[model samples]
Target chain A: MIEVKDLVRQFKSGDRTIKPVNGVSFELGKGQLASIVGKSGSGKSTLLSLLGALDKPTSGDVVVDGVSLAGLPDGKLTEYRRRDIGFVFQQFNLIPNLSAVDNVMLPMEFADVRKSARAQRAKELLEQVQLDPEKHSRRTNRLSGGEQQRVAIARALANEPKLILADEPTGNLDEQTGEHIIELLSSLSRDHDTTILVVTHDRGLARKADRRFRLHQGQLNEDVTAGR
Target chain B: MSVLARSVGNAFRNKIRTAAVVAVLAVAIGLALSMLVANQAVGAKVQELNASVGTTLTVNPAGGQGFEGGGEPLTAAEAATAAAVPNITSVVGTKALRLRTETTTTDTADAAAGAAQPDAGGPGGQAASVTTSLTAAVDAGTLGNRNNTGSGTGTGTTNGTEPARTFTLPITATGTAAEVDSSGKALDITSGTGLGDYSAASTKALVGTTLAEKNNLKVGSTFTIAGKTYTVAGIFDAGTTFGNNAVYLTLAEAQALAETPGELSSMVVTVNSMENVDSTKTALQAALGASKADVTQGQRNLETAVSSLNSVKGISLVAYIAALATAGLIILLIMVMLVRERRREIGVLKAIGARNRTIGLQFVLEALVLVALGSVVGAAIASFASGGIASALVSSNSSTAAGATGQRGPGGGPGGPFGGATQLLTSVTASASPGVIAAGIAAVFAVAIIGALVPALLTARIRPIEVLRGE
Candidate 1:
């Protein structure tokens, strides 16, 4: 579960203040999948960052699983992100020199997982994401865009977080590949009872989520008709 | 993966670059270790010189120097008085004599050159008339013959009144009160033993190694001096050709042979410490009544030599430090470049919940690995190079000091205290002992850690949000 209360993030541009995320509030239930659709500069990614604890808010708080993100120290914030939240970026930022399995095992290593259990867990995650068994040993840079994104998804799930925040995860893939990624995310939410939030520009992808919201002028509004 | 494992993997990501860096580092470290070994060797040599030759004083007859001055030979009474001076540890008396074959006679030119004829007084105010049945081992070379023959009939003679004669080299024979030479260095006896009592007249003599070899003599062999038979008690190696072409006899026997009983050519007096040398010299002079004996310290040549060696030691130390600093700088620059190139990797590690300490530790571990490889090769290079480098340094510096002081050249004077001092200057032995090499490598590692840690700590300032956003 996730909660956002009147979150406002401001930045100074030369002389004037710009609020990328202004007076936003929302909630998502457990096992639910949601999407936020907005144009460029509409703060869709900014809101997701606040919920993931990657950036601090100028005003208000974000609570995940009843733990407040406001004014938390750096150490505790890092632990929260590592233990409770996972992130999938638009560029699929996997280390290029590492094999797919090695990239997936990185987060578990940081979490101090047993060295003997990490490789097995990483392999199972890769299987769950439908990556080819042979590709697991290939460097991420040599993999196709779709394969790399799958490895990134597998990495996000390595620590078994309660929530996953994906900011334009399919932004760099073809339309057909993006559809498959969306279906995979939906299935992950339904099967694991994990909360999933996606920020995207594709209305078709947005319509398949359990709940749909549109961000405009730093404001968030739900679209009931578009939600399945 | 563990931070150490990851660091090891990352260090060789570019194998060519790592090899290049390690090669350069090994050379710098090798040079540093060599200089350190040289410095340590010179320091030890200086200590040896100060202990052995620096503390001794020579007392020769007043107005009796080389072959020109004529004065009364030093007597046993004067030696006894010198031994009573405060801080005097021991006193050794010597009687000098030159022996020629019975058939050889000194010509007029030889007589004028102080190669005086029979019963004529020679160096150290001793008689040169002692004849021996043993033939000379060394030839009178071109210089000796030229000096003796002149441009006359080439058959050496001042006039027809003197018979034409072939010049022959004389053998130097010294009478010592102890087993040591005039410079106080113990004889390196290679065979047999020394005379049992130096004060009692005996037929036993210590023959020089070269002289014994040329004459086909060994320990227990018999030889005749002035028709008096004596047995070789030992064969001694004096570490030089000229030094090994002589013989040593007990002071009493030499005095009996020269017919100068109770007389000594010089007395070598040992003081307890070098610091007490000047004061001891003054006291000995006062005790001997200055007019009766010439008390000489002969430390100017020794000081010039020791000063040059000290300069070499200082230079080697400075060079060692400079080389070490060069190694440190190489590590620092290489680590800085690695940190800059790996900024993205650092940001990613931070994003993945890795602590700043972990990332910094990785780079440091990587640096230590490089240094370890370099040190192995550097130690080998130092072991092979240190000796030659030290010898070269001593040779150059000692030669410069020798030139500056204009000390006596080879064969210019008798082998005495001054000769030993000159030899001490160029005899430093540089060895690369394991302990010194190990200490050197340890210092290099310490400096390398500091050099690498600087750039490693810079990783703490990288922000994941900035790196990712920039990407």
Candidate 2:
């Protein structure tokens, strides 16, 4: 359900114009659990940002569900992000002052979900992500790193977006917690028919995805048989 | 999770800081409200003065200012001519008279001359002394006896064997062509009514409270003036001891008593407005002839008092503006700081698909909540403090003017024809009316909205991608 055609995103660093995402091309079918592995500064997150429509491309286009993001207005792109795409970050960027349930309910509120339904939906999403019910009422800052990551995952699923983007989702966790988070994402994609793309530096995590892509020198190449 | 709920929650994110901001804003808003109240009170007083004493013109006989100046008294025909002048509202003629008890001999004419001069520059100039059987209410003290004895030594002893003789005070009496006194001010009657008809000669007189009390006279009591028995028609409180030691008679009776028929001591001409005072004075003079009459604008003391009141009005207006600005600045600075501190939250909200308008509205709603709290406290402070602040401002400014003009009287000095314009200046009362206070709070809210919007707009410049990437 995603298509990238020669997508290029450029920026000026003093006298040089650097292309973090350059001439990239790829495709992923619906419900596909995919991973993009790269060394530090290899532009793995940049490619994910392009697919998420969080940033515009300098050339070519990113098509998701047959809709081209190339020249879409900022408002329409924000709407696409709010209604059809969700993001999880390495830092688990949950608002520190809000409780875990409130963090999950935020995106639903932005989507204009009915106020009465948001709390119940948020609680169910938190339970689906394996967060304990008691910890759901605690502030995100007071939770452990693994718990915060679980809350972030619940927040991303709030609006039931078709695609999810995870940038270094396990970068701050221990090996065991990181493996559990990856398994949780894989299960969400398989059970809910949701497309998932995780950008990471861990090859072991990358190998667990149905499709594995290696990003080097601003280019992407997929591994045809990874999960099997 | 509504924007309103989030904004309300954010308002109290830092309880101590919120309290501090509200306290500071309350002080600034309170000061602004106080100045606004003072400004309104002074403005009303100015309008009152302009309507009452400010718009009057006095016409005296040419050179009839002092006791020795020689000129023919103003005639009824001249008064009528003045009344016909353009912009002249009404003209009230007055005849000044002084009455002495029959027991007090005129052996001391100099004392009578001093008594004939008005203690507080009445519209009617110098009074002509007349003998009457009515006794004066006030006792002639040492100075009075010294002036009456005609002896520089002031012992009242022409010879060593003669005991000091007692002298009775002379009573100042004015005959008015209207119910008002010579100053064109309505008498504050304490009991009974005014002289029924000013045009006709009647045996009815309005007695001063002090004079009536001293003579054991009440309304309907009888007294004799120039061998003609007159009934006490009214007792009036003139607001001053000197003003209360007098009586009022009809113009015709006073003129006949002075043996000067068809003559008037002076004419108090009311004009339509103070702006027309100078023009009306010129017109009245031209109509009555420069040689026949001299027309002067209201009281000199009134001019000084008005100048001081104008200063008060100006100062209060400026202070009000300054305080309002300070309040606005406080809100602006506090909002800017909040926006800066919450940049991360703004970025996260934007990333979560919150619109720019939603974020801006949140900050504005938060600001309005703070302003509402401040206004409640500020209004309470103003309700209690406005009157005292206004009184202090008027007193200081008017006293400065009075000192600069050196017009404070040692003995009930020369306070224009309306008792004392200086007294009017000191009596200005400032009240914190609800309407005025509400209007002031509305102004503060308006400023606060503008103050909040500036910082809220700054949120638009924050890019979620940039903030997240940096983090």
Candidate 3:
């Protein structure tokens, strides 16, 4: 579950203050999938960052699973990310020199998982994302774009976090693969009871989420799609 | 998936960059390690030599270094001041003068044979006479188990006229046993004994090898100097003709003979170590005044040799520092580039909940790996190459120059104290052991960590959101 009220993120830009997320508020239930759509510079990513406990906002009260994210210390925020949330980026951002499986196992390593268990879990996660065992051993740089995105998704699942934040996860993939990734995320939200939020420019993907919110000029407008 | 595994994997991400940095570090650390070994080796050799011979300051009348100065000779009081100076363990003072000998063949048969010879005044009963001059001193001869008598030499002469041709012999009348020991000029006695157990006050004498052999004089044979008879008690090998013709007696006899009851021509002050030589000389000068005494340290030639060799030591030390710094710079530069290249990956890790230390640790580990490899390769190369390089750096010309200096003496006067024995160093070989290698590795590891840490700390400040935004 997530709750945000009056969140504001302002940055200094050459004597001018730019508020990317200003007085935005939202809430989403557990096991729900949601989408935040916005034009470039509309602060969708900034709000997501605040909700993910990745950055401090100028003013905010964000609660995920009853834990306040705003103003939390760095250590506790990192703990929240490590134990409760997973992130997927538009670029996939897999560690380039590492094999797909190694990339997938990275988060688990941060969690202190043993080497053998990390390897096993990474392989299973890769398989769950339809990546071949052969592909799991390939360096992320050598993988196909879709395969790299799949690896990123598998890595996101490595720690089995309660929430997944997909930042344009399918942005660089072919349309068909992007659709598949969206379905995969939706399936995880429904079956595993994991909440999911995707920030994307893809309207087709956004429409498929359980809830949709459009961000404009640092303000949020909700479009309820749950129970559709 | 482990931090070290990930770091190692990242180390080779840019093969060219990795190899370039590694190559630079290997050479830099290699040069550094080699210099370290060379400095240590040369320093050790010099220390040993210095410890063995120690140091001796020659405090002479201020004006002349040799026997040519015009200043008044040091008085007994002045010499005492020299002895009392800090670092001066013992002082031996001397008063030298030319001793001209008058000889006559007492053997009537040899005289008849000499008279029958054309070179003998054609049997005109021209009692053939020869005159030889020597510099006799009241300074004690070095004659003890303590190289307090480090290395010195003396000279005398023997005429072929068996009946007795007057040959001038340089004689030293020693005042005390310790003074004699501090002379370091004491010859190794080949026959008989040491001036009678190092201390009996007698008008007895010791003859050099050449003098003993030439006149057929044995331990009990008597010789006359200043018209006083002295029984020979020993024959000593002085290693050179100049040294082998010398003689020793009690200081009272030589002063009575020289007629200078309380004057010192020169003073030798023994010091404990070479490090103390300069200070001892300074103190003696301060005590006696600059115009009163010209202080000369023992083994001037060897000191010169070591001085020349010390330049290489200096350069190598500088090189070691520069190399270490350059290695650090190289790591810092490479890590900066690496951090730039891996900015995205760092963000991803951070977003996945990696702590600042975790990310920094990976870079530190990577830098350490490169440094570790460099140390092994550098040390291995230095172990084989340093000996030759060090030898090459130590100019053989300096050693020869030192030899020439040692070989030089008043070919006709006493060889003085330390003959050619001051040839202390020729070549030095670095004897690096496993412990040395281990120390080198430890140093390199530290250098690597410091080099990586600066950039790694920057990584800690990276914001994941900004990195993702930039992408």
DockQ value for model 3: 0.59
Top candidate on DockQ is: 3
The true-versus-predicted C-alpha distance at residue B349 of model 1, in Å, is 0.9
- i-RMS for every candidate (Å) is 1.7, 1.3, 1.2
Ranking by TM-score: 2, 1, 3
Report lDDT (Cα) of residue B73, candidate 1: 80
DockQ of each: 0.35, 0.44, 0.59
B1-471, model 3: which lDDT tens digit per residue? Answer: 678887787777778877877888889888777777877887877776565454777776767543353666567799778777887877766544333343355444333322222122101111111122333222333332122121112222225542222222333333333324224544578888766533334667666777677667889988776556778887777676655656655544444455555655566678877667877777778889987777776665556556655766786778777888888898898888889988877887899989999999999999988887788778878788777766765646344545565544566321335443223444566856667667766777788789999999999988888787764
Model 3 alpha-carbon drift over 4 Å, by segment? A12-17, A225-228, B57-83, B90-269, B272-297, B396-426, B431-433
Over 4 Å off, model 2: B63-71, B75-181, B186-265, B271-291, B294-298, B373-396, B410-436
Tell me the lDDT of model 2 at B411.
74
Candidates ranked by DockQ? 3, 2, 1
Worst 10 residues of 2 chain A by lDDT: A219-228
Task: Kindly provide the TM-score obtained by chain B of candidate 3 when compared with the true chain B.
Answer: 0.57
lDDT for each of the candidates? 0.83, 0.82, 0.71
Query: How should the candidates be ordered by lDDT, best one leading?
Result: 1, 2, 3
lDDT of 1 by residue, B148-187 (tens): 4532111255565754555676677889999988777789
What are the per-residue Cα lDDT tens digits for candidate 1 across A1-228? 788899999989999998988999999899888999898988887787778776789999988889888989877877887788878888888878788998999889889999889999999999999999999999899999999999999998889889898889889999998988888898999999988898998776787799999899899999888656
- Candidate 3 has what TM-score? 0.71
